[model samples]
Target: MEDGKIKGKAMVLSGFDQEESAREALEQALKEAGLAREAIGIIVTTGNGRKAISFAKGDVTEARAAALGAVFLYPTARTVIDVGAEESRAIKCDATGKVLDFAVNEKCAAGSGAFTEAMARALEVPLEELGPLSLRATQTIPMNAQCAVFAESEVISLIHSKTEKADIARAVHDGLSSRVVAMVRRVGLNTELVLIGGVAHNPGFVESFKRTVGLDDVRTAAEPDFVGAIGAALAAAE
Candidate 1:
């Protein structure tokens, strides 16, 4: 994911059904990144043969990796918010991204990058245009749906009403922010609130987040999207 300011990459070798293939993919990525091939870290999930692993050169991963590593470093961080492509997560962790308490909204696309992508498509715009376009809105149109289907309908209505596309975009950002902020509160708004995952790239979303949560400090890695991979790598380092 590219946030204009930061970029991250993650390769999940899911559906492999074999540890060997998974291991090969992991090794290849590490070698390509110029990381030591001997360095391996492992994390076992609830599913069989579905392991999350990481490889790096040092005692820990890189700085982006360290932000995720920080979660494992702190056993008391009860909340982790990860906003990504298909869904957004409010995870309660034990100082590690090892989810202890977690809530996710995957049933709908309203709060995910997918929703933003769809909107951008409907507006005949590119994803890179969203941030600057949203910043141009003189006023935010009200969008009241948490489900993507309903939100799409609302957006169409706005288009019919001749609402400025910028206003509509800002409204989408507002709606998503409200839902995610509620998720954070539901998971118990603790300090060290780490905001990771892909959607963290949206400047409007970030600004709306700061406003909605009344949080003076929000933590985001240089590469927000790859925090999970980085976390997996960090766990393996341990």
Candidate 2:
């Protein structure tokens, strides 16, 4: 980020060596921006691997970073919901990105992107295609499993019962959304809901979450996955 706005962005997969991955991602970002390392100033890190980045000047909690990033992207955002591969969080904040309250579902894969990935595998569909496939669903088939392991089995059973893949996909997203909505409720839902994290890119989950929360105007940025990084940058700027 530059001049209080994003100038360039890059992403790399989190491999076994998190610090190495962070370095590679930073290098990519710098290369994309055509800047040398010395051109950069402060670095504030957030997320699960924040502590692994020894070069960072400071670190912030994931929830706080998410809140800051969401409010930065959408000034009116009062509630921030972030659903990643391993965890999902709901953060209540004001226009200034001050976190008032927060809740997280960290213990369950069923409430994270991992659940959708598992269901997608069970349906023999690629992860990226799952969302669009779910949009083709004609009806909502309630998914009973509350665990990812069992959810995969339940998806298989649906396949055996000749259920449409699109319906099954929708059911998977619905189940994930229900759990996310419950988490958001703990933090107190407010107007201008903003969704950040990799899962925000999933249209099926977005639609399901909007319906579950009874809000059609949920907001998201162009690159939802980078919100935490943007938040960290915002913190560094401060």
Candidate 3:
């Protein structure tokens, strides 16, 4: 998950259908990381267990503590926005990282890594090239919608119109940032807003976000995409 690094502890849980495999993978990862076997904890529960049982599972308790640690490290974080591959989460947490309130966009691909990847592919560029390319734009092209399908269609239109790739990419960044800003605003804007998830890696996305939200201080984790896992690991440490 660290892009090649295999250091650090991890507490992992797979879906209810893959509980056994998930446990095995966590245990093996712990061993490979040279962490103490006793430091590793495994808890397998059905989806119903998570829903019906409020009790903390073995490893989950630690994961929670780790998340809290990361939260505490940032003094001004009251809102944490995580944009992942398939879904997104806007978590409103206290100083302790307790989930005070939250919203998620899990049912669609419109505002996620998948959306950006699709756009990047359509533009004939590598995903990593997107941020820098967009940053080079001299003008802002308008992207009219948050819906991925609509946006893709719009991109085609731009291409046919001879719109500059840099301009179009900038528009895409603006569109995504607007969507994320809306989600964060729902939780109420807080100082030192933290942006997590794979999308945070995109400088264009981050810059657009800062501008759209009109926030002077927007921070990103060293490993933006892995904040959840890092937070989970930090929670486990506690």
Candidate 4:
């Protein structure tokens, strides 16, 4: 960021080597901005591997970063839902972007992007195709498995029963959304709900979350995955 304005952005998948991925992403962003590493003022890191970033000037909680990022993008956003590969979180913040309350589903894969990935593989579909494919569903089917392991079994059973892949995919999203919505309820939903993190790219999960939360309008940034990084930068600026 330059003078509190976004100059460049980069999104790289978090690999087993968190520090390496972070460095790669930072380098990409610097290249995009045509800036040297020495030009950077301060570096703040957040998310699961924040502390692993050796060059970071500071680190902040994912919830705090998410709240700041959401409010920065959508000033009116009071509720923030960040769904990532390993965990999903719900944060309630005020107009000034102060986190008032928060909840996380760290223990459950059922509420995370990983669950969708597993389901997609079980259905023999690509990760990116799962969302669009689910849109063609003709009905809503219940997925009873709360565990990812058992959920895969349930999906295979449905497949054997001649159930449409679309319906099964929809059910997978619905099940995940149900878990996420329940976590959001702990923090309380507010107007101008903003969704961030990698999972925001999935239209199936977005649609299911909207339906489950009973909200027609859930806001998302153009590059939702960068929200947390933007928040970390904002924190660094301060």
Best by TM-score, which number?
Answer: 4
Clashing pairs for model 1 are 41-236, 42-236, 71-95, 74-95, 75-95
**What lDDT tens digits, residue by residue, belong to model 3 across residues 1-238?**
2322335544344455455544565567667677765654533232212333333253343224323534855656777777766767677778778867676666677777777887887788899999899999999877886788878888988999999999889898888778777887777877756777778888888888888999766898667644555554444444
Worst 10 residues of 1 by lDDT: 1-10
Q: Residue 50 in candidate 3 has what lDDT? A: 33
lDDT of 4 by residue, 1-238 (tens): 9887998888788899999999999999999999999999999999999999998999999999999988988998999999999999999998877899999999678889999999999999999999999999999999999999999999999999999999999999999999999999898878578889888999999999889999887887678888888889999999
Give the candidates in order of lDDT, highest first: 4, 2, 3, 1
Q: Write model 2 residue lDDT over 31-121, tens digit each, in one string.
A: 9888888889987889889999988899999998998888888888899999998999999998899899999999779989999989899
Per-residue lDDT, model 1, residue 46, is: 16
TM-score of each: 0.71, 0.97, 0.77, 0.98
- Per-candidate total of colliding backbone pairs: 5, 0, 9, 0
Number of clashing residue pairs, candidate 1: 5
Candidate 3: residue 58 lDDT (0-100):
39
Q: What are the RMSDs of all candidates, in order?
A: 6.9, 1.0, 5.5, 0.9
Ten contiguous residues minimizing lDDT sum, candidate 2: 1-10
